[model samples]
Target chain A: MIETSHLSFTIGDSQILRDVSLSILPGVVTGLIGPNGAGKSTLLHCLAGLTEPSSGHVRIDGQDPFTARDDDRARMVAFLQQSPTTVSRLRVEELVAFGRWPHHRGRPGPEDAEQVAKALDAFDLEELAGRPIETLSGGQKQRAFVAMTYAQDTPWILLDEPLNALDPRHARNLMARLATLANEEGRSIAVVLHDINAAARWADQIVAMKDGQVLAHGASRDVLTSDTLYACFDTPFDTVPHAGRKLVVAT
Target chain B: MRPWVGIGLVLIVMILASLAVGAASISDGDGGWLIWVSRFPRTAAALLAGAGLALAGVVIQNVVQNRLVEPTLTGTPEAAMLGLLGVTLIAPGLAVAGKMLIAAGCALLGMVGFLALARRISPRDPMLLPIVGLIYGGILGAIATYVAWQTDLMQFLGIWQLGEFSAVMQGRYEWLWAVAALAFGLYLIADRITILGLGETQARSLGLGYEQTRAIGLVIVSVLTAIVLVTVGAFPFVGLVAPNLASRWQGDNLRANLPIIALGGAMLVLGADIIGRLIVYPYEIPAATLVAILGAGVFLWLLHAAPRRA
Candidate 1:
């Protein structure tokens, strides 16, 4: 389990995350949703140990991510930042192979190669493996980056807006892959999403935020109410049932 | 593979031509000693300096995330020159190794300073970076020029300004071998350096020590630039041209491309030295002047090609 206790992050006099405490369970997909400037990304960065909280702490399986060595922390949790940037001339397969760097630390064993092949196959990127990332389209590049994150093979995968620049079809495919990884493989996933409908449809648990504070946190159906959505986004949201899943639409 | 073989053949031809085509005839009496003392050292210096500068260029480009900025553009060589000027004035009797260390330290600081300034600028217009770097280098160069003038070291400054292999003798150019060792060190960490091109956040997420790795890269760049500067003066654009050309041909996989880049650099410098020897026919133009002329053309072509590539 990854848990944060009374975590607060500040830059100079500006507070980005204030008194936020959250627990992300294993074997589930937790979607963090909020309006712009709602501190969702900051909280995600804090949880991923990319940033340290000004007060309190974050723990992954009872160990503080901040105090852990980089390789050790990487083994425990893999983070994909929003708008992930890569070297232009790097090939898709090579980029994904970098995900295994924490495990091999530059010396790739057969197992590392196997995991890279698996990641490429998982993301349907085998065809593009030899292509340089700069030559790929937006959706393909996004898939390549996600495949890289998957190849990290950590117990906890934290993605900050992995769907950026992706079309609806590609976004849905990515979400389905993440959901399968969570449900079948028992890996924990915490994704910060701008699209409310994606979170409503794919998330097993939902954490809603507004003004640097948690507005709601519970099972998807419980926390994704019209009232909580409206409060978090400062806009009216209507939740309707579709095929036994919640479909959220802004009104 | 065929292309590599072709390049190797070309390099061999150039090396042989460079060794045999200097002012003194290698086939004449006492010519073997002349070849050993002058021709061979000059050839080796060209190759080593070219390889080192090109390697340094690739590392600096990755570190700063800009292909246009090389050691020459980033004020690295000028900073080293400034350090050398200080050492020459403060302690004229200082050993070459001591002078090199100080220059390398100064080059590192200068490169770091350039990067710090680069961070504040948006990378939208890529050409702006090199222009800014050129101006920054100009300012530094001006300062060095002022210091050299005040100290009556104008002739020394002039020699450094235009890199020439003409003066390279057996003992004078051996320091460049340190760059060869450092280039081997660079090869070992080639992957880490490539990861650094991914920017800090991605590098950090991949369990790479971003700051430490970047510092190591800068140090390598500094040492490489210092060695070249102290030994055979500054060769502009070899670093810039070789890596850019190699990346264009082979992509940015440093592990696979570094050797090619090194070889390409050596070839370009060796070629320039040969052309410099033959162009004026006994009144050789400096290798730096010819490289500048060739490099400027390629650099402009790169600028024109960049938009399409992007």
Candidate 2:
């Protein structure tokens, strides 16, 4: 379990995250949704140990992520940021091999190779395995990076806006992959999403934020309510039942 | 791939020619001994320094995540040059190895200062970082130039600044082997360096120690540059051009580019050294100055070929 208690962060004088306490359960997909400047990314960074919180502590499997050694923390958690920048000329296979760095440091044995191959196969990147990342299209690159995180094989995966440049089909495909990972493999996935409908469709739990505070967080059914959506987004969003599933639409 | 292979072949040919065709002439066994014992050290120094500089360029580009960044462009070499100046003034009678160690130390310190200043001013704006480094280099270079002018040692320092392998003999060039060793060590850590280029957070997520790896990389680069400066004088752009060329064809994988970068750097220096010898026949121009000109031309071509965002 990953937990944050009374987390507050500031950049200069402006408070980016304020008095936020959250618990992310394992074996579930948690969706963090917020409008622009809502500190959704900031909170994700805090959770991933990319950002140090000014007030509170974030613990991943009971160890402070910020202070934890990279090898120790990497075994428990993996983070993928928005538009994950990479060295352009690295081949897909070599890029995937980077996931094993924490496990073996730099020396890759036969087992590491097996895991790398498995990651490529899992993400359907086997065909493009030797291709340089710079040559791949936007969607392909995103898939490759996600595959890298998957290869990390951590219990918890945190992704910040992984679907930004993806088309609808690719986006849906990525979400399905994450959902499958969570349900079948018993891994925890926390994703920061700008699209509300995807969150409503795929998220097991949703945390709604507004102005750096958690406005609502619960099971999908509770957090995807019309009142909560409206309050968090400051706009009217109608939550309608479509085939026994929640559909949140802004009007 | 063929072009790179061809370049490699051509470089080997040039290296042989460099060894064969010096002012001493090949017919005389005495001249042959001069070539083997005296000039060969310079030749090896050229190969080592060239390859080392290019490799350094590649690492710097990756570390800063900018295509245009190089030792010369980013003022790293100038900082190294200033270090050389400080060491020369403070301890005029110091051994070459001692001078190199001092230069490396100062260059590492300068690099740290640059990083600190960069962090303080702006984290993401790399354009500012190089500009700041350049300004720093200019100030340092100016001080060095003024010092050289004031002291009767101006001519001696000027000779060092304009890189020449004319005086490199066997005993004088053993220190370069240490640089070659440093380059190999860098190759071992190249994967981590490339991973760090993705960003600190990404590196941390991958279980790589970002600060530690970066510090080690900068230190290695400084030491490599310092060794070259002390050994072969200050040849600019072998680092920048070699890495740039390697990236064009070698896929920017540090491991993949290791040998390629080394060979490319060797080729550039050897080829330049050969050409410098052939031109003006008996009166030899400094190999470093000529290569810098060639490197500048290639650098411009590379600038044009680089991505717009880079």
Per TM-score, the best of the predicted structures is: 1
Candidate 2 structure lDDT: 0.82
Model 1 regions more than 4 Å off: B307-310
Model 1 chain A weakest 10-residue run by lDDT: A81-90
Local accuracy of candidate 1 as per-residue lDDT tens digits, A83-139: 766544789998999899899987899999999999999999999999988788988
- Range of the 10 consecutive residues with the lowest summed lDDT in candidate 2 chain A: A81-90
Q: What tens digits encode model 1's per-residue C-alpha lDDT throughout B171-216?
A: 9999999978998999999989988987777788778888999999
TM-score of each candidate's B chain against the true B chain: 0.98, 0.91
**Which lDDT value does model 2 have at B298?**
88
DockQ each: 0.62, 0.67
At residue A157, candidate 2 shows an lDDT of 95
Which sections of candidate 2 miss by over 4 Å? Answer: B1-11, B117-136, B151-153
Q: After superposition, how far is residue B72 of candidate 1 from its true place, in Å?
A: 1.5
